[model samples]
Target: MSLFKKTLIKKNYKYKLLDDGISKEDISKAKNVLNSKQITMASQTRKFEETFAKKMGVKHALMVNSGSSANLLAIFAAGNPLRKNKLKKGDEVIIPVLCWSTSLWPLVQFGLKPVFIDIDPNTLNVNEDDLIKKINSRTKCIFLVNVHGNSCDLFKIRKIAKKKKIILIEDNCESLGSKLKNKHLGTFGDFGTFSFFYSHQITSGEGGMIVCNNDNDYEILFALRSHGWLGGTRFYPRRLKSYNYYAKKYPSLDPRYIFVNSGFNLRPTDIQAAIGLNQFKRLNKLILNRKQNRKLIIETLKKDRRWENQFQFIEPSKNINPSWMGLPIIIAKKYKKQKMKFLSYLDAKGIETRPIISGAFTNQPATKLYNLNPTKRKFNSAQSVQELGFLIGLHQNKISKDNLNLIKDSFLNIEKI
Candidate 1:
């Protein structure tokens, strides 16, 4: 290739999406924190927490080290002895099969049975019909996956959870900045979690937050976050009574050091908080750019002469204004078995791709080893999604004409491959 072609390819190649859209302002905030040297989880963390809670419209937000930890906290907090109506061992939690491993594992790690739910082919989220049918007396909660920044009719899901008295946990890891009917995705559930991992809606390198509406739940989560300590509120009379009767006797020992509940050390650094807050300020811009890039890619391919119903774009469901993180392409049935060749071709062409959130997770080797698939639940849509669906980055920067053409040409090569 000539030097000109090399430069063009370098400029036109679809790069990995920016997980952290850090403007000059975000870096300045981090530099200020670094210069101050109060660098663990302090002032910036608190500010980020307040701003996040207010933005998400939740009563409280607890920043954690990672989204996976946020999930673990949410699951374990539900089962905490301090919680009045806690999820007991053997109770069932409904989760979509087309989900990330962490979302499903947390329920099982907490000793709650995970009832697998299939996703809608069109939406790539939990099917409402399947969800309603699966709700039984033993059902204690439903852990929903707002897949790749898109969600189902969360209002309907919330109504069902309320009617059944089941806990609603929104695994909003991929769907940050997304809104359903004008409400944020995470705020509808009893507990909603967000991730700041690289390539997600926003990145802090590795960080997460959990949101809830109840004061008691907030207190439990705060205690659960760091060695179960009630440092901030132990001076209160009520918490003292619940602790050892000797809390008063140990007054000189700093009532602030009071241990109140089960806990873990899942706190983000001040630096991550600074960066995350900066990205949060510009979240709308990131969401809009990614959405536009996604449209351009789709339009480029669909307009090509080689376009022949080769793939289907997973459409957002009703009332879902998506903040897409990546573009998921579902190959048509005739080309389903040719998935490997097509993806391999794309990969060879330097177009990065990945499976759609580890697809039909029940089909995983570990699940089979545990004999979790014997009941033979029909997950045809999830199965099809597994076989056909693959994703590529929807970058923050605008897709140029040449890059868009490259994507279109590569995608249309489905015929030749």
Candidate 2:
């Protein structure tokens, strides 16, 4: 390595949320796309979407600019005019209190009322029972976030959703390679979303995918992902019957420019797709490395004499073989007051940390600004999570002895702080 590169690595050796997110091979794939001069959402994106769909065990996959855009497309498609069963204004969508902002915002943006259900403190996912209880006649959808690679009985939830005829969308952004009962986490819902953000399971710098099984849903998503045109650019061929129908119906309109539905420009570039596909080819290895690193960190801390139950690690839920996004740690109640100080100490020590999914979405000021919770009902479990939980990076490679020691020493200092 060059001196500058070596120095840069040395400077970040203490701890980082990500370590060289893109591999040399990933960059090479992106470079090839750039050299081809066809870097738009074309063949590379389609190829990645196809491989992703087959690997995910889904019928279709659509690439977008980011996971947020994936969620937005899923929401808008679920409520699209062409959809047989659609959500409308004032319809209720069930979501976990401990969720990412984008997971909740799309519902609100679609004019759907969000019914926030508390998460299980252990799994950091929606409590299956609480979620079921919150479902009512108005509950048209359930937007579940498989938090930090852990999920709450998705089979049970899927059954309930099917029985109630409710749309189920899984925000599996943080758990792309994870599985429950040998099936991928994202495949159990009507729609599943995944992210390829810098710190996620795989990195393409910034990209995401939405997947579904229904043919009509795939068509809806295809049109909505672009500018609602029946035919995409010459590079993106449309074989769907709807394109033909629209083309024949509007004889005067150019077949290449037939507009059929409301949409957004959420397409991912070929460069991002090339990088994402390259990373995805090694997803299983990445997942395994992260799992091993997590195990090593937890074992190191617990075996340490200084370990006095100062922290709690989130274990994967039953039947889940997780691909963790990060190592989520919940401080003991005694150190709850010192959590902020401990985080600051870690930061100063060159150990990075973040809140667990921004801590209960309802606690955010934006929720208050939108008057989402008029009743002021509290979610105590979510509140406790907000107070106690934080996350550290789980690198794509095995933890080094020095890095392991750094984490162990810095984390155990919680007691002293």
Candidate 3:
């Protein structure tokens, strides 16, 4: 089959990976922003940022174009020359193997060395012991990923970071509504990022938010989100100093266009922010629905006649209250080779599926092009996930009986494979 022909003939599944991500209410909110004709980062965006910061218990939040941009901004801000304790070139940064490409790319883009750490397969997060062993005096930062709404012991990881004086940046994009113990997963580090993508806990079509507690970091993020322009929160007298001081010093230069630091234009539109804010109001409800749907699917599968422990499901990590993005299932070792065949059968039967976060990042072709893992070091745990794991969506709405039956039937097709 020709590539174009194949694309045209791709399976049309009855159950989609994500249902109508934007609701009527969400559209109404977005329409209001559109009708106002004030779409570019305005009052709506600022309001969303304030509400997000309050809910996440962070001092400040900056909305961005996408989760990838959020990651880029966080790492760039960390390495920016304007920061007092910024990372320099060739500094080592530790990250998990089971992470998204954007999580690792920013470190490489900034000339920082990335040290790969394996994940604990059970928790689907970084292996703390291995992470600790990889840390040395050269390590300047820890860009940890909270995988699939689960996290490693973030409290212990925070303590380790504190002891080592390393900057902690949590890629909490997949785990936004998740909590570790009583504290939220994203709030455990110097910088934490969240995604409001189509399949996340909340959806805004395409958007992301970065949060920080320190006033200086917040100011840096705000400026960086724009074109490095100086004035963001001029309401505060203290914040006006950068503009005032520079205006006085330069005399001729316009304070409005002062490019104080290196930056990127990663701002989210007001329409996206409006939709995200409306969805944010239903976040708790969405989280609960997904959790219940996951339980129902697991129970329904177990009750079926085909139930023979053909798959293993990932459980929430200790001291964590998860907000699942999907139902991650690992095929039995005996069925690993036939995984693709089973997945195809599921698709043919009108059930949709996806790989677990693009499997292990090191195994990707882009990693080789960038020479990310130069030593070709093996990540056994991560590799196992690549070989054995696949996921099906757990919707934010309760699973209907028809959909539940379809899921059970499709999953049980593994027996034939």
Please tell me which model should have the higher TM-score, number 1 or number 3.
3
Candidates' TM-scores?
0.90, 0.96, 0.95
- When summed lDDT is taken over every stretch of 10 residues in candidate 2, the lowest stretch is 1-10
Q: Judging by TM-score against the true structure, name the best candidate.
A: 2
Rank the candidate models, highest lDDT first. 2, 3, 1
Please give the distance, in angstroms, between residue 352's alpha carbon in candidate 3 and its true position after superposition.
Answer: 1.4
Q: Clashing pairs in model 3?
A: none
What CA RMSD would candidate 2 show? 4.1
The TM-score obtained by model 1 is: 0.90
Candidate 3 on 1-417: residue-level lDDT in tens?
Answer: 131232246756677777766789999999998999877888888889889999988888888988889899899888877788899999999999898888999998999999988898888898777788888999999999998899988888899998878999999999988998778888999899999888898989899999998877877887788778786533312243466777888877877667777678898888999999999989999999999999999999999988999889999998889999888888888998888777777766777777889888989999999898888999998899889998888887888899999988878877775
Off by over 4 Å in 1: 1-14, 17-21, 232-253, 369-371, 374-378
Q: Which ranges of candidate 2 are over 4 A from the true structure?
A: 1-13
Tens-digit lDDT track for model 2 on 11-96?
55478888777788888898999999998888999899999999998889999999999999999999999998898988999988
Query: lDDT value for candidate 1?
Result: 0.82
- In model 3, how large is the Cα lDDT of residue 205? 89
